[model samples]
Target: MRFFSQRRRPFLSVVICIHDMAREAPRTILSACCPYQKNVSPEDYEVIVVDNGSAVPFALRDGAGLSPAPRIVSMPHPRPSPVFALNWAARHVARGNHILFAIDGARIFSDQLIANTLRAHSICTDAFVYTLGCHLGPSVQMVSTTQGYNEDVEDRLIAESGWPAKPSALYNISVFAGSSSNGFWKPIVESNAFSVPRQLLDKMGGFHESFASSGGGLANLEIFARYVQRPDAKNVCLLSDMTFHQVHGGVATSAKVQHSTFAQEYFSIFQREYRFPSFDAIYLGPLRPEAAKFARIGLAE
Candidate 1:
């Protein structure tokens, strides 16, 4: 079902990819939309959610309260990897000059995410912007889940954090993921939320469809490495912004999977497909008091 907003061409387009996240997608969408995100109007950006063959198709009611509702596209026969679905939206549906990929739909954005992204682009039109990745728990979900953390525990943590009413409070409950363990001062392997110019994305042919592993198996890392390697690209990391991941039995974050075994298989595929590169980013945005503590943690590392 199509629910295109009549807004003008937005400066940014966000393509969120999800597969069987019926329980978590609503909060994720809400966090990226109006009232929750600060200092940005709906006209400034558009969100396109690509449902990658969920058992239960995504419905309009999942994003009911969102103003200028997201464009929901379903891929009934989606490949195991989300690379194809994400690429299809960027190539056909996205109208913004710049496109942001939320490779995991369960991740929620910080309040100033959109405003900070626009500011970074304005600073350098060729900027490749990303935020520090975080998990919505006392520690990374992969570890915390082993300690009995689940969606019910995560929901309680969110309520205690005072989100929406006080969105910055998200920092109180989150920890840097293993990919982002080095913190803001250092480079992370990949970003759950990252953006680039439409032209550049097209030039790179969007995500590499060759990454056919379940949940795109290191596909996000591949794209980030490729984009940052461009001599013309400016890597900007948002110090005050982040994407908080919600636990929903994801391939990498769930206790249901054998983490080491899954990592070994995916890394082997990644190694065969592309060369992994270390990334160092230019930190941007103010170090707000709420986020200052996390910055210190990264620096301490």
Candidate 2:
């Protein structure tokens, strides 16, 4: 059953990949849908969620009652990596001229994400637009989990933050991820929420399928690097908007013994396949007072 249908093609297609996130998917979907996402109409974008072979598959009801409800696609035989699923969705399911990937489905977006992304696209259609990522705790989840953080703790944190009503409050509760800790002026290793023109994605072949590690390894970083390094692609970082990640026991974000092992493996694969270069971005979006501290984090150093 299709949850979304529009007369005209949407301007942006949001592709979100999930694996065993039944408890967290609903909130993530809501954060990306109407009402929660301010200033953007349902017709402006379409969300395509790929369930990468979870033990309990994600259903349509997860996004029930949401206008432009996410179109959930389940993979029957999924691989350890999400790259295959992401590529399939981008090539087959997406209908937008620009594709925005929230590769991790556990992220909750800032309200102005969609609207500001559209504004950035208007400024430069070929721009590679991305938002810095943050974790819903005192520190990054990998470290926070060691400090007694979990899904329950995250829920309480979100509840206390008064989000949706006070979407900007997310900044108050979240600390920037290590990749995005350097502030908006510096280059980030990767972005949890990022958009690129469909053509540019196609040119790069929609994420390398060889990133066979459980969480697509460093595939996200590779895509960001490729897009920013392109001479034709204008990298735009949204200073006001961000994606707040919930604790979901992810390969990289969770506190597990395998975390360091996975990191080394992924980095080795990345080094063997491509180079990791620091590429500066053209900062965009209105810097909200709530977000100013994060945006200027390392600027004085």
Candidate 3:
């Protein structure tokens, strides 16, 4: 069902989680949303912009003259962490049957993104949320738009990485897939990618306070697997055709000390969940010692 802006109540809520975004990034997202809103019926959806403790404050209430004035909620603390920020954002606002987590950085992909996503949603049933593409590309440039069933941005690493995204392999796989970069779904307020229904959120007691930062992707995967494993709940669904991911290239590897920590922690989690061969033995290519050590720590735990 295609949506037009004038419709009153919406079935879905688009949530944009932000933390210390550069001056122009937020504007770009809003611009993208304007055209998106035009295509989507307001009766079927709304947009919520969560200011996750940006270093530079912005006009959330005013929308700085953006097409739609996003309901803005500022966190009490200026925490730079995405997970914490998103939780705080979801708690204060976001009203929709399903929440689409759209990252402000390089997460926005094409004009028909949301429309395409919901189209895929019509056919799937599982606890799994559908993620579109896995393209890791230039941060600022609007990558070429491709048509057809698959609209994902292509990544040079897919062939070389040699890692498969199997359900059981969620432990070993990197959460940094090309498709996961951008996704559409209900409010996954607990920091997990797949938004659990209100009942499950209460049951799980929200995200782990110990699991800090954006690396919760792996934690989320584990959660997704466990939750869907229940006999009564098999609603998780993965819609590969509707999503696309764009990896921002602004930050260099050396600049990612904090993210690396999360990566290390994830590897450890992977080790605990899976009895894969030695890290080096399983790796398709060379494994960094630090990366290997983190997995070892998880094993020791």
Candidate 4:
């Protein structure tokens, strides 16, 4: 069932950076490396989790349910530099021709995310891909949750009888599309779930290392602004998937706008040099089961 029966590189390398997400790391890792994920096999993708100096470092057991278990890296110092953490992990990747970067380690992904993205990437070499990023928490409860999405509420819903918690199925994905620079369906400027070719990632110089903002360098946003509009890049927005964030005391997501001094500083710097992509994505239709390319893995289109 492994994708790499031979010696070829994996289809993708999932790189996740963590600062202090002890509560959410396990869920994030499990979701990404779950044996049940049909989109891509354990052999087809490499999962790397970098713990950037948390009080309690991430520990993995010998036989975690995750096959080809996740590779764990612990940093010595605690710096609010997810940008650096990501590049550090990227440098350590030994396989996988493509890179799947998760800006936040708290995100629990849908099982089909990999399969759907792989299909899109495999078919279109020039398109820039983005899976919808959904904030999980009460709508308007935090700066991050523009809408009601309480994780506890979601958990309660899932725990109920006949709940829709199947990991292999395609999950609800919000589509927001609009025209920009004569292009339709622009990717959200701050999406946390996105995949890019290793070569293209290198071409973009990875995440910008200069920002060093208190809260994640906001380098994730900066990178998207520059590349999606590149004269040569192809922007492709996936309408049937999502990366659900786990509610935590996130720096930007939890902090009040007036209290977000670091974010303000970073934004000032960002605006001085970059113009954000006009729109996140072209608003399409509501969620439907037709979005999933693979029913489970081999069920076929």
Candidate 5:
């Protein structure tokens, strides 16, 4: 998603879109807003929660802990396409030099996720940066973990611990594999969360709102493909940071339920597979001790 014109600010605005995630909303919002340390000043980053036509009307009350808190926006009607809500938010309310899109509303993030991303962006301003995706289950494996995803299991575990999400907990559960030459950080199939200069996304005409599919997978892939394919754009993957997905019967990631029909439809329309970035990621390696310490603060007990 993009904002038109040439307005630049020093800070970042994160837009998170949710359809119906009342239970997972609190944890997700808080996790993003409650980072322990910021590479940039707290005021440099803002979070925007877009309740895209959820039946329960997701609230921004959990954001009270932030210095400025997060702003809440809503879609006028329920739409199968998350793209509609995303474009709506980007058009009306985003205020940042760069905009980061987090499509899933039900995610608990590492404390270092935002700070680390900001650090990368500050260093490589022209680059497109994205977080390493993780799913919440027995471990913090990649989003496409073979164990699959189970919302019930995640809910029960979090409820028993009574902790929202903490650095230590995230560390304990994180899993890694060597898909690349180095160990640890592997190549990601898709990035659910990514950051880009507002102008760049705008130049691409924002998100294509034609996707009326269950989860807007085609829209996401199309937007990301353009970003990756840009020859001058550096693609940086924040290795230390990860976004832990909380299952909400996701149209794309729900392992138990297959989206073959949706996939076929998407293929027929595009005449190709959802293009994964062909380039290897710019990996800066593992989390530092100080960053890990800072991350611990985001967790709730």
Candidate 6:
């Protein structure tokens, strides 16, 4: 009745970061996920959920019936940022060389989620691997709720993307149109998935500790551009396999705005301190990576 295959114990660490989750939301997530964990045999993996400062009611403990009994890593920051929460939780926990960050609000659609991601990483030429991130429809409340199977459900944006039907299925997608969003991945923290060498966390001196709360401005993107976006980076590949990320529009908009402003201001500070040419040069490189084959010519500028 456990999730995962009983015969095989895969090496993986599943990290879920939670903040300001409503009373029912956390239970809802666990309820839906528990069955899948049982069906999939969760013996091989470790699940760690980090509780960031939350304004609303929170369990402060794992809800009853939370199968696999995920470890509760507490971040008592009265007002901690999501980036900080994730970094704290991931810093010393999870045993596998592969680390996955699943948003607390996102439901695990298939038990095969972890299995497929690892399979992709095994074959990837790079050391780090990225799964095609997709949003699960709001109606699905648990992993068992996941129905139907479609490999091409999502369009492939990266050449490495593919459709595989195995222990699970994930629509190959970039959460924000292939742009990075806080979601799942292995060998990298959820907040720093786009970075190469995975160890960039220590190299960058860990998440910008300056920000009081969420929105560590351009910190995430800066790492991505410098580490993962480079053409020569190796051992990293985005999984085209279908994994479902539940979408409930659950993130706190008020909190999100506060962090956005903070992120923007903090990023500007980096620009000023570094004398960078343009904020876009430092922040939104997606718009214009100089080496991009599709760069705009003079008139388009």
Off by over 4 Å in 1: 1-8, 62-65, 255-276
* Candidate 4, 98-175: lDDT as tens digits: 778897888777666777677777877745677656554333235424455555555553344221246522233211
Q: Write the per-residue lDDT of candidate 1 for residues 102-180, one digit (tens) a residue.
A: 9999999998898899999989888899987889888888779889899999888888778768888888888888888
Expressed as tens digits, the lDDT of each residue in 131-168 for candidate 5 is 65555566433353556546666767666654553454
Per the 3 Å backbone cut-off, how many clashing residue pairs does candidate 3 have?
A: 28
lDDT of 2 at 270: 55
Residue-by-residue lDDT tens digits, candidate 6, 152-178: 231232123422222232332323212
Q: Candidate 6, which segments miss by more than 4 Å at Cα?
A: 1-10, 23-41, 60-67, 107-111, 124-126, 135-206, 211-223, 235-263, 272-301
In terms of lDDT, the best-performing candidate is 2
Predictions in order: lDDT: 0.81, 0.82, 0.40, 0.61, 0.67, 0.41
Report the poorest 10 consecutive residues by lDDT, candidate 5: 176-185
TM-score of each: 0.90, 0.91, 0.54, 0.76, 0.81, 0.54
Off by over 4 Å in 4: 1-8, 61-63, 76-78, 140-158, 161-165, 168-187, 256-264, 267-274, 279-287, 290-301
lDDT score, residue 246, model 3?
33
For candidate 2, write residues 1-301 as lDDT tens digits: 2223343568999999999998778888988888888888889899989999998888856456676778889865689889888877877788888889988999988888989898899899788999999988999888889989998988888888887678888889999998788778877788999998876776665677667888877788887888888776588999799998989998888744364565576667656544555776788867889898797788788
C-alpha RMSD by candidate, in order: 3.6, 3.5, 13.5, 7.4, 6.0, 11.9
Q: What is candidate 5's TM-score against the reference?
A: 0.81
Candidate 2 vs 5: which has more lDDT = 2
Worst ten-residue run, lDDT, model 4?
174-183
| Overall local distance difference test of candidate 6 | 0.41
Instruction: Indicate which candidate wins on TM-score.
Output: 2
